[model samples]
Target: MKKKHNDHFLFYSESKTKNRITINGQEKQHAIAVLRVEDGEHIQITDGQGNLFVCEVESVLKSSIECNIVESWSVKRITPDVTIALGLTDRAHFESAIESLTALGVKKIIPVIFEHCRKPWWDKWRRYEERFKLKMISSMKQCLYPYIPELVYPTILKEVLEEDKTHMIVADPNGSTLKSEIRDKQTPVTCIIGPPGGFSATEISEFNRTKVVYVKLTPNRLRTELAATVLCAQIIGHTL
Candidate 1:
């Protein structure tokens, strides 16, 4: 096998018990037309579920490509798994935000609908589902991270408050710095952020009512997109 960019070669979205991996859609197009991979060539494949399947090209077709699985293994999930619950925002901006988070190794992204969030932001995901997904996929490829962050939908803040498995951290300018809160090193963290205009008073009261921790970075307020990523990146910084 010839060497290329070893950080990332290619990946399959699906990996099961079979000895071969079948790749279709844009992955196939890129492999055949762009990468110019020939038979017997080696490529990396991932199921986006912490598993990496090393494979060799068996055959290439117009619509898809086949590769014989050479070996397979799983990467351990990141410790202190972080989930970013993002309130809806501009489509392009949210896409960029999720893309950056996925690259940074976030385990999950929940597209939340807060009380002050714009009404149109609720179902906006349905419109750009494919494009947003592609953004994360491309981000994963660029970063050479095998596991793609799980994307969840327009959940309400109240509903998110119910998840007890994660140590929920809500973002507020009045809250403490990111470095200060996770000092206890809580695992399976879920950090929640408000919309462009910020969370409503009632929502804050509800958050306070819960056992959730309130945390912030600087006295200077950051945009929702930057804030969400900053919190996640900060978690990684502390964890590592």
Candidate 2:
């Protein structure tokens, strides 16, 4: 098996060659200014596509940082792709959810504007999309994860329900245990977490109309962000 660098800071770069890689934008600035990475220093890097590169810093430029690849390998993606369809909530909570889910290796996140979600919050999602992305990238690097979770903003409950045929797991207080819902690791999952206020009657009715499994994460109420992270962890535990 290939060795893992658990302590080195992981940088992200899409521009890479067989034996070379370049870190640009905020990541470049971070390596230079914040991490103070210098020539001949080794750093771990990911392409955000399941590949990790252990590299030695070649030079630091005014615009970007260049590195020579010492070794590289691919990390397999987590099995049974997990997608989180979370209700749009307050900025801080929603962003927190993004970070938490990314660290758990969720494949994708869809921000749905459910009935309980405030219209103002939904409207602001687009403006904060970039910031949300940065949070995912930060979380991925912190956990030394190879891939950044995909983010889709400004959607609705109805749209998600009809998006695909994957198994849908809805987080509810009065629902059944998660163990019964997640049986097979090969089956893809789309876990839905409502806003902090919970899903409305109409939304519940919509769920009833379609096929979905309701799993209760806990008997007590949880904040929207916490509920989302819990659900992701449960799915991973059961499936793995």
Candidate 3:
């Protein structure tokens, strides 16, 4: 089994094992203001590229801090290549979907605007992307994963399906069982989740014509986020 490190770490630039390093810019502020790390304190550092460095703070300043690297190792993370394409919904449901997908180790998230979706909000998209990125990063840090999930801006559902020939599974409560529908699928799966009111009849027909298999989670209806999470969990659990 691989060894795990149990030490606090802050991101920094100019990190090298067995040598002095420096932390500056936003990272410096986060370390000083937020963490209040002091000199001679041991901390881990990463270049955000699968490298984790063990180091001790040498000095602290207003905008930067210097540290000496004691040890370094490459971090490996388990990230699924599955892509989750979800229809845009209310802010609460949208945010919940992002958080749940991140926790489930989804690699790519594509927010789709369906026929029944509310009018797009550019500000909400930007804010949600930023917040989702931070959440993914925090989750990755907590789990010691080296990669963060990617969040794509809202796009048209038709376009996404046309571009990717992935194993497509759409969640429909009245559809076939999930296990029977997606029992044996390879990687790079793409699952589509509709809005709260679910897809319209016309939309469902179009989806079926496009060869998107509809999978049912349970007999009881579920919220948009709940359906998305269940489908995602099934895909990840089965694939992994």
Question: Which has the higher lDDT value, candidate number 2 or candidate number 3?
Answer: 2
Q: Is candidate 1 or candidate 3 better by TM-score?
A: 1
lDDT of 1 by residue, 174-224 (tens): 787777667554578999888898988898888878888888766788888
Off by over 4 Å in 1: 1-7, 15-17, 119-121, 183-186
Scanning candidate 3 in windows of ten residues, the lowest lDDT window is: 1-10
Candidate 3 clashing pairs? none
Point to the candidate with the largest lDDT: 2
- Give stretches of model 3 more than 4 Å off: 1-30, 33-35, 46-51, 66-80, 181-186
- Checking candidate 2 for backbone clashes, the offending pairs are none
Q: How many backbone clashes does candidate 3 have?
A: 0
How do the residues 1-240 of candidate 2 rate in per-residue lDDT, one tens digit apiece? 332334557999989988999999999988878887887778899988889888888888888889899888999888778999998788888888999999899999998888878746666556777788788899999898889888876788999999785699999888999988886888889999998778899999999999999888997899988999999998887777
Whole-model lDDT, model 1:
0.80
Q: What is the lDDT for 63 in model 3? A: 73
Models 1 onward score TM values of: 0.92, 0.92, 0.77
**For residues 89-127, could you state the per-residue lDDT of candidate 3 as single tens digits?**
787677777777766777778888887887566446665
Per-residue lDDT for 156 in model 1?
A: 88
- Backbone collisions counted per model: 1, 0, 0
lDDT of 2 at 139: 91
